[model samples]
Target: MRLMGLDYGDKTIGVAISDELGWTAQGVETIRRTNRKADMKRLGELIREHQVEEIVVGLPKNMNGTIGPRGELSMEFAEQLQNTFKLPVHLWDERLTSIAAERTLLEADVSRKKRKQVIDKMAAMLILQGYMDSKKRR
Candidate 1:
């Protein structure tokens, strides 16, 4: 089964997808969030087009492992996803994933402005990649 990964942010939703074998992840398009309804509409199209089976959303938590405002918002997004698509939605811990993505982009010589534009999508890729790797080890 295929899975779509998301990094939910205030203004954008980073997107990634698992490989057909569900063993790898690749960066996909990022969805610019307008409103809940608009975001869901765009996600529905992606789900249909990609033949997605499940969704994996990044769950942001505070450094001390507590849910903050962002984490609560992510949960809300996951609920909407489940309600609309009727598919299982997994919330994967994503603390520091964006930081890791930022460091990676820096190492790759990506410009600051460009990194800002794509960091969310890259973070989603990291989250999806981590999930895929763990599944492989299982």
Candidate 2:
């Protein structure tokens, strides 16, 4: 079954999807959040198109392993996703995925403008890949 990943922010939500075998994740697109209804509608379309069976949302916890405001926001968003999609929504710790994505892009010599546009989607892919890897290890 396929899985979807999301990196939710105040202004945008990065989206990624796993391969049918769930072995790899690919960045889909970044959704610019204008309102909840629109966001949910777009996500519903992606969910149906990808045949997503589950969702993984990035939870931004503090470095000290404490849940901060951002973490709470992510949890709330996860709840909304679960309620809307009627599918399991897992929260994956996203401590440094963005930083890692930035580093990866820099190493690849991506231009700053392009990096700015794609960093969130890259982070979503990283988060999804991490969750898929953990499931494989189990």
Q: Using lDDT as the measure, which candidate wins?
A: 2
lDDT of 1 by residue, 69-112 (tens): 99999999899899999999999999989999999999999999
lDDT (0 to 1) per candidate: 0.92, 0.96
lDDT of 2 by residue, 1-138 (tens): 999999999999999999999999999999999999999999999999999999999999999999999999999999999999899999999999999999999999999999989999999999999999999999
Tell me, by TM-score, which candidate is best: 2
Worst 10 residues of 2 by lDDT: 5-14
Model 1 lDDT-worst window of ten? 129-138
Cα distance off (Å), candidate 1, residue 89: 0.2
